[model samples]
Target chain A: MDILPQLILNSIIAGAIYTMIALGFNLIYGTVKFFDLGYGALTAVGGYSVFYFYKTLGINIYASIILGAIIAGIIGFIVYKLVYTPLRTRKSSGMVMLVASLGVLTAAQAIIAIIFTSQFQTLSINAGTERVFTIFGGVITQTQLITLVLGLGIMIVMALVFKFSLFGKAIKAIGDDEEVSKIVGINTNKIIGWVFFIGSAIGGLAGILIGFDTGIEPTMGLSLLLKGVIASIIGGIGNVYGGVLGAFLLAFIENFGIWKISGEWKDAIAFGVLILFLLFRPQGILRR
Target chain B: MTKTAKGILWVIALVIVVLIIVNVSSKGGKNSNTASSTPIKIGFTGPLTGDVANIGQNAKAAVEIAVGEINSAGGINGRQIEMVYEDDRCAGPEGVKAANKLINVDNVTAILGSVCSPATLSFAPIAEKAQTPVLSYCSTAPKISESGDYIFRDVPSDLFQAGFAAKYTYNTLGKRKVAIINVNNDWGLGLKKAFSDAFKALGGQVVLEDGDDPTSKDLRTQMAKVKSSGADLLYFAGFPDGTVAGLKEAKTLKLTQTIFGADAWDDNKIWDSLGSSADGVMYTRVGTNSSDAFKTKMKEKLGNDSIVYCSNYAYDGLKILADAIKTAGTDRTAVKNALYSIKHVNGVSSSLIEFDANGDPKEANYVIDIIKNGKAEIVK
Candidate 1:
């Protein structure tokens, strides 16, 4: 049986995850124009929250996921109300906002460590092997298939939100020109707060999905945030659709590059792709 | 004076008063005892923060527990064992600084750790210059001990673990074709080379090799490519975080087959994270200490069901140091001599830990453990 299709399927699955993380990350970056290093930490929060709800509180996993998303959204709102909102009101420079985000990242990470004690934790209800499925000579797991479906569903919903919703127009308006958006009677501050909420909640969903796929640790967010940022940068910064496309492209390049060589070169291939993109198409495939 | 400046001055004065009081109390203990009766101080340095902090924390915890037991057993030769803990943060420069602190400030006679091999190597030169013996619990590279007389390892190096992992995958698992993925670091690179050599020696074909930057998020592409490579099993030589992430992504894409890794995969968290997906994933580890003595000791101390192998090793490292101190009569050359001549010495981890001339454990074997019911179970 040909393994190429299976590898392609796997790469697509990975791309879906990166898309989710990058989509959320880019939303916040587009609105705030500042990097939130703590975006990854929010994912950890979502994962830990779900773990607590399902494993510790004995809630259903689905219920825990909803609760985790809400918790992440609430935390995002707080980040705005407590840190970002005040700083923006104060008319802080981009660098100051960047540093504040760093503070948030460090504080959020430390809180997770203190709460979870940095132990590797997972939520598995049963002792059973993973079920594998094959289609068209390609193999995959049931969980993975679910992830791919969920990713597409989320992407479609986001696309519709951006296209048809009034709030989406305001966001796009702000993305184009924040001052003009405010002058045109768009509640820029309120819209940005909502953006943080939406973006962070999505980030939280990514975290929960990742926790189910891998395990959750306090520091897992940092790496996730890095990938999300890379995908965003590669896809076309500040563009949701572009970010998703970039994530898939990134996944495909890394997965396909090491077709014959040892798996150890996978990451090198990823960075090489990034460097190639930076060198040739710095504006990205879909520029704003 | 401005309000803030006055406040700062007050805080400084308060700090000075506390320091004076502490110094006075500390001096009282010294003045009451003869200078010749001071305890022999040893140092343990390892990463207390960052990604691999858990490993170092376990090592530190084990050392504390073991050293506590030693001191209670009436310190070596009437000279009490004093230990200094350093947070090396797993960096080479940090390791050097930690070693210097132990030597200069703590005045330790020997040094026990610096968890990663690079960190251990960083401190080895300093220890050799200071003429202090160094025993490590986790640093597994073979070259770590090659620096000379002062450096030793408590466990077998990665050379043995990787070779054994490769041999087991080829012979026991009966896999002819394998694809290997490793983290792009010294630990992963070194282990991969060893495993590659051993796997080839066992007449197995390595179809694909790929590396991941620990910080990289997209590995599905490489994993998918491996699925197409027609490898029977996949091996990942990296930490628990990356291993779980990669395996989960690989599974999602339906590249299902047997997966193998080394001691890096023995983490309890990895199994829990993967849920049902973790089942049938096989990894290797130095056999767990299932002895009654180990159980009793763990029950008395940690009160945890999953007895970590690293923590046990750390505990053994401390006990060995303590034994050396006692046998040597002074925390000086005697402790080092006792450690080298250690014969049939026992600890809670293993029934017997007899160090060879090169400071390598005489007996270290790889046991294949499968993820069953979210916990590792011995397959053979």
Candidate 2:
């Protein structure tokens, strides 16, 4: 097999994962206009929940995934109600919310490490049983295929909801002006809460998919979060479609950048692309 | 001075007085120990927690078993051996702290420990400065051979394993072209250099060489590169987590190249994670010719059949140290000399062990084990 097809497939697989993360990240950022560092820890929450339900309790994989996502969504909703919402009510600055989220991220990660002992865990029931399929001379596993398909499906659904749904319109209005949206009978807090639930559920699904594809560790959330943040910034922060576009672009560049060089430089190439975009197109490839 | 300054000064003065009194009392106690019935203190450090905690804890258990046997045999010169253990967490700074505490606070005659390479390296200088011998049971980095006369290891360095692996791949397997993927760290870099040099010397070509961060979970890009490198064999140097991820990714890509690895892949967790995908993969480690009696004893002590090779080495290390102490009689210089001149010491891992000038085992046996039916079976 030619290397180009494999590289492209690798890029697509990576892009799919990044897209899922960036979509949920952008959705939350669009509504709240704050960087929720705790969003990263939710990925581990989703992965560990599945490990508990599916692996520990012997539940069906599909049910475990759904329950894992719901757990993540509920955690996200609780964080919003207890921390972010109160801070927003106090009219705190974005930096304060960012710091608070960092605190939450650190605490959650520490707790997970204490429980799981910092060991890496694979979520697969049978390690070598996953089916492989060849497409255009590129080999991909069943998990990778599901990840790509679910990533695209979720992106489209998210876009449609934002475009056509009254709830999404209410979210946009609140994002534009929270006090004005309330005066206009938008119920800003309730809509934002729903947004938090949906966005976090999507992030949780990405986590479950990634856990199945690679593996899970307590510290995996930070790296996944960084990739999603980079993609969102490169595409255009707070723009849903832009985040998706930037994700594939970042993935392609990262994969091709290391074609001849060593793999250790992959992270450097990613951050270098982000710097270039920040310098030339600070609004990203798309403007919000 | 202000009231706050005076308060602080008073506290410092009180602390200094308490320290002086404690120091004098400790010295008096040491002087009273000359009657020769006091317990001989030995300090031990290893990763009791963290990623490599299992290996460290196993080594500790082995040492404890050895100590129990020694005490039952009436101890060295009728003085019971006492071990004070500290957890270094398999990190360098923590190792340094543990060394300092063992040498300065616990006042041990010698130290045993530090299962990982970096921890052993970090503690070597401290042990050398304190004139306390350190016998590391598991650290196998090539640099440890030159770390200091006081620093010794029962495990052979990666220099031997890498050369052995390279020769096996080239001469036995007849692989002309090999690709190397390694973790970017001391052990990995050492193996990469040694393997490549040895393979090239054997008239084999290294087609591709790349490094991955130890914590990296995704390796598809690197795997794709290796797949297209036209190499018949791939030498992967990684720990358990990295090995599992890399092998899984390679299997997903259906890469047909034969995989070769180092001793770290001898772990059961890797096999558990890789399952059937681990079949046909080969790795090398220091061969253990442990007696069945010893194995049974260890399993009984640990309450499981999870004894790794390092545990055997640890058991031998404590026995050797005890012998040296018996011959030298509480003198550090005499014990060092005894260790240098020791000969034909029987160990669980080997029938005889003699230290070379560099404090590594002079002659060591290496075994190549292949994963067959998700279990490691000795091939040679």
Candidate 3:
């Protein structure tokens, strides 16, 4: 019953979740070069969509997850087309885009609150019969285990795509320089649109998993987004592999920091690390 | 100018001037001397829209039922009781505004409401300044005991609950080392302090203590610390959302210590979602022994079988206010005096309530309940 094993297990579970969010956020930030606050709302949208399909409409849970991810992807695409794309055409500043994204986040959260009545909802259908597995003196539920596996699988696939896929090359070109990518016949708009969909779909998967692991709330998105943003920044923003590394590091730091202190200091410890990084190593642990 | 035309215009203007003066005077007179048979206005403030809206709305429904029963029986002193409800949204600023509106605009003699402790604390000063008696049905922060002489609540503060829980854990359950994890809020902090004080007084050691933001969903880090503390029991103080998440995480970590909680865990929604995971968890709640007749009435009214404990307190709060008005008339000061001295008031919580020097219930019967098969059963 060494507590170290349990603490490590908890850190890994949290790190897995943060990795999913940070990867998607880093991918989008690399190309867009702007903070999409609306990304948080999409997390809620993904969870609620599955809740509607599986719980309300009686669809199969696995199928509902696919549909929910697709719906989130489409919504992300629509937001780009309607808001960001138009703003880009108008030559708006990044600040303007950030503000617009905030507006979208607020409106989306309000809509979800109205529809879901601001009540905490669990997405599990078999919460009562769910089984627990012990590993190295630490316990984990099935959903958490799946979360770890999903995080690893996604990271491997993303790394391979970045290395080999033509679509990935197009994305990198655009991220390097959008104007030059267009002149080089990279079809920047189409490639960026695809990036948004894929990134948002990954974010949606994270949301769905979170809903199963804990529960869903309208305001859950903002906190999740904050953690992801922190991970991306500390991991070297826009660096895909670095984002994953930063996520696990943050998870470990936060969990261990509270090992001998009050849990109320958890958030303070996170921001303290962020501030330290900004002050001493502005380039983060892994500089691009 | 023609003489007849000027004369007619002057007469019409005079008539209009006289009508305005009469109307203004009558409006002022009506407010000063409200008719005896007119409805006695009572203002209610609670969260009808935000996070804790469920509790607020439930309390409102129960109070309305009590109002209906009172009015049908020809209300106190042959006057009907009318309730004006304001949505505080469970925030401090919102509660302040609601209290002002209820006092200044609505001109109510008494106010019932504000389920959340922060909201109640925010509005208590305003009610005291206005000399309006405010009875909170659910707010249980220990600070409320000394908030104001005019501020009252039917529900006992967390002091009683914490003391009960501490004794139960130390004596009945025979757990010596205890760890505490609480949400950082008025309710949580109050219980945390009270329980810690009581536990230490009973010669039990507090091994570790921590606080979490109410909005935080993850408690694994805190659970890890709790597990390592070598504590035989864990006392978690939080509302339903945080509690459910914390419990799930503890179960995942296989923290086998007994978990103790406050009344916030009385929520059925949490138990239903938790399923078998909630089994064997114990919590202390104000014993609500509502009659079958009341349950049937609440079911027919709310379209549900379950009525939260706060709703019963709210129902009793209205009855107590009416009884006070009957005994001391509608004058705010007289009603306050009567409330301060009110004795042996029968409430649905299976307790006879009498205000102490500080306006809290002098004594409350706290019952320990254990969850079994997704239902909370009172431990005998």
lDDT of 3 by residue, B74-117 (tens): 99889999898998977789999999988887788899977889
- Order of the predicted models by TM-score, top scorer first: 3, 2, 1
Candidate 1 segments exceeding 4 Å error: A123-133, A275-280, B1-34, B46-62, B86-101, B163-178, B202-204, B215-236, B246-260, B271-283, B287-291, B327-338, B348-357, B362-380
Model 3: per-residue Cα lDDT over A95-147, one tens digit each: 99999999988999999999987878889975645678888887778898998
lDDT of 2: 0.87
Best by lDDT: 3
Candidate 2 colliding pairs, count: 0
Candidate 1 matches the true fold with a TM-score of 0.86
What does candidate 1's lDDT look like per residue over B116-204, in tens digits?
Answer: 77788888888878777788877777676576676777777788888887877777778888888888766778887888888888899
Taking chain B only, the TM-score of every model is: 0.86, 0.92, 0.90
TM-score of each: 0.86, 0.89, 0.90
The CAPRI class of candidate 1 is: acceptable
Docking class of 3: acceptable
Worst 10 residues of 3 chain A by lDDT: A125-134
lDDT string for model 2 (B270-343, tens) is 78767877899999988886878778888887788877788888888888888888898766667777888776
